[model samples]
Target chain A: MSRGTLALCAAGLLAAILYPLVVRGLAGAGVGVSANYLINVGMLVFFVAFIGQSWNIAGGFAGQTSFGHVVFFGTGAYCSTILHVTHGWNPWLAWPVATAAGALVGWAIGALAFRAGLKGSYFALITLAFAEVFRILANSVEFTRGGLGMLIKADQRPENFQFRDPMWIYYLALALCVVSLAIAWQLTRGRFGARLVAIRENEDAARALGIDVYTEKVKVLALSGAMCAAGGTFYAQKYLYIDPSIAFGVDKSVEMLLVSMVGGAGTVFGPLVGSLVLTAINEGTRSLASVVPALKNVQPLSLIVYGAMLILIVARLPDGLMGLFGRRKSGKRHDA
Target chain B: MLEVRGLSKAFGGLKAVDDATLDVRQGEIVALIGPNGAGKTTLFAAIAGFHTPDAGRVTLEGHDITGLAPHRICAAGMVRTFQITQPFAKIDVRENVMVGAWLRTGERAEAMRRAEAVARQVGMGDQLDQLGADLTVAGRKRLELARALATGPKLLLLDEVMAGLNPTEIAEIVDVIRAIRDSGVTILLIEHVMQAVTSLAEQVYVLNQGRMISHGTPAEIAADPAVVEAYLGHGAAARLARGAAHA
Candidate 1:
């Protein structure tokens, strides 16, 4: 990290810390016109960004490009939900176990796929297949409550991992986002990151250069899976309910992938920027639809715009939105 | 030191490499020369553990590394370069080399330092900041060598480092190879550039039709009729011999 980047990061951190407080003070809590909706939106952006960063770690940095990252996400959600609701385990305790389950699944999948010499599209398709399998299993399984889904009884206590104030959950999301940012930052400066980028660029070359490509890929997927699973736990805690569709949905997978891709897949701040854009579009379209009074739901309007924007991003900005800021110097920052 | 005993590899019905034997002594520079499709790259892959040999052994410093993974073979003190250069295209040259440097040292700073030193050794000192994709053909070739060299290998298997270089570039790389050998890394290179082979190789091995036909000093291998017959068909070799007599 350069002094400029360090200063930028510090400023961004300060801005994030102040955002909710500023919104509450300015708007004075209420409903649609107040800060409440914006606060929720802001919270959601951070949460999605957090999970998207998990996808970015393996898909963007390692070039694993998984289409089924929700497998880990759903796995995490179901593990914690099952343990907390069924086994009477504390959510806090269950979260870690859930995260571990995600990592183990990631490790197993990575070992199976890479060991079989699956590469490129094949590797991606297998992840999608795995996610579908998990989704189906969760749909039919006894402990998961099948299609009915499971819910945590409302116990609004900080110790119970539930919050009376939404601001607290928002802050938690912010903390997770910051930690993930640090992980990405760490990758940019370390040997592990270098090895991953090498594997991403050319696995055969990386192997010939004495990099254990298989181990590195497996390690990255494990790391990615853990981070994603943590997000799953956060999601369940926030919503208090996780059904089969919500937990293992392709929509969440696409959202995670889209945020990373649109922002800047490999960069630390990509998912954050992407989530902000997505939330902004959603709100912007919602307000526009309210004025028009004919739009059935604002979501379709936003989706059209989002779909168009995605095409533009893919066509013009291969490096995502971060490329616009001249962040191509991802290699020059080792001096820090 | 490296040794290969009757290494053979076949893909389905086509025997890509059959019963090939070669050796690189401690601090020696040997050349493997053959026509295109003479199974040179396949043999390099087989020895480097990219391809599993059917019935033979490869020993690096007297340990059997025949069917080990490519990374394990690289760690065991032999690293092979590709005939067609493969660089981390998005990463810069120094970082690309650092990927190999990370093999010995896990420290980022130390690996970067080693990568820089290797880059300089390959005459790529000024091009350190260039992206791997941005390099010219000769630059990519040098990048390949620098990357493999960063691993601190005992033996470097260079697959046509000069395949796409001009004469001057070829001479520079040849000098770089010599410097690498002098600095204590042995080399076993596959070359079509007979000049580089003659100038740099202490011993030359000729492979034809998935087999090693001859092995000797550069002059002796150049004079061998079997080597000529392998490169040119029997009719062409005889005709060339007759033409030489007529001349």
Candidate 2:
């Protein structure tokens, strides 16, 4: 490992060792379990980061920006929710099914869109339109509970992956978050990573160097889609609810992009920092609104905050915050 | 050896390349020269498999490569470089070259080693860690050559590499191409600078109005009426030759 990689691993180990104690200590005090709740929120934030990181494989790394990733998330959620509610299936069983479904959808998209020569901004638009169409379809479909939405009954079952305690959900999400980071690290280090970077830089040049651009691109897209779909399964089991607006919404995709952009799109550790920072701000806004009744009337402040953060990060620090600390001459300094 | 037969391409009603045929022997340096818009670039593209010809057959040695993808063609022991450099601007120079080296070995460490060696060969070793976007035009051109070389190509198609270089840089690149040819790589160069062509091309092919106007030694092509009329216009070849002689 390089010195940089060693330092990052050490820092991550330190954080992992300290985070649980911090949560337990806060729970000991009269902080009303806010720390625990925030930790739970952190899991969601990290989940968003994972989506962002996965999205980068196709969007940032392959130079194909996709705004329809939430479709996979929705599909996973619906698949798991229906299996558990209607057929009494275990969440574990639903996980692989959801992943396969996601991969299939991704392959279909790649075959159609790439073969037709859709790329760049045009690809982004097509993905966005696809997500919107899925959202509309989910809202109209009766099996998805339509506008009534799907809600789980209040229960505690370890096998079902449902509990009254949010801590269990937190641990599960934390595990997924770590796995996502590991996958992202592997991707950016391996030969496949180099191919993606080459294609992103120049497709024609990559093709002339014997890199199969279409096959590599589709493979990355499938990986990204599967990751997002798995996240959807986690989301459904944790919250015990699925709604068209929450599950298939375009805003979810935007949130993923925001976290990735804020962290550093092509960099390995960018999404982690972005998730931590954004989640803290998000939780802080909710707590402040509870304390200050005047802020209760402000419904969309979190979104406004997200938008402003994206703009500020893009304008002042185009390379993201970590880039400011890295050595500039190395050109490994995150500029994008 | 490389062979092309009945190569024809058209844009709407106008033919860009009309039933062109050519062959390049092993270790030979072939120059393709033509007036502007005579379809030299187009023909190169077709040969490289970027464009599917209206009707043609291309073969490397005895292996047919008709309608194959560009990457597939590259894997068959050929690579190409563009007139406009297409370096991976966001990455280091070595990493840009590594993209090509990955074609052969597909092992990161070995590819990187080869990339560095090729960078040094192309006179870019000191700038290995430099961002490709930050390089000067000449540096970018060298990076392009380095990348093409890193692919372990047996046949290299170079398009307008000398277009914007000064006289000194042009001479340096000419020397590099000669070295590459000496290293057992057959080269097909599309060049406008006659001086480099005259110095390096083992055989010259001149195209005009999408047809081969002449094909011979540098001295013979200089005397061909159609090649001269296509380039220097009527009665100008003699004066250009005198100018060359004086210089």
Q: Scored by Cα lDDT, where does model 2 land?
A: 0.82
What tens digits encode model 1's per-residue C-alpha lDDT throughout A1-336?
A: 778888988998999889888888777644335676777888898999999999999998999999999999998998998899998999999999999999999999999999998988999899989998999999998889899989899999998999988888889999999999999988887888888898999988988988899999999999999999999999999999999889888888889999999999888899999999998988889889888877856457988888998999999999899989973564447682
> What would the per-residue lDDT of candidate 1 be over residues B1-247, giving only the tens digit for each residue?
7899989999999998899889889999999998889999999999999988998999999999999999999998899999889989987898899889989997888988999999999999999888899999999999999999999999999999998899999989989999999999999999999998999999999999898999999999988889888877777767888899999
Per candidate, chain B TM-score?
0.97, 0.93
Best by TM-score: 1
Q: Residue A162 of model 1: what lDDT?
A: 97
Candidate 1 clashing pairs, residues 3+ apart or interchain? none
Q: True contacts preserved, each candidate? A: 0.86, 0.78
| Lowest lDDT block of 10, candidate 2 chain A | A327-336
Candidate 2 lDDT by residue in tens digits, B101-135: 88888566788788889998878889988888999
Question: What do the candidate models score in CA lDDT, each in turn?
Answer: 0.91, 0.82
Query: Judged by DockQ, which candidate is best?
Result: 1
The 10 consecutive residues of candidate 1 chain A with the worst lDDT sum are: A28-37
Give me the displacement of residue A269 in model 1, in angstroms: 1.5
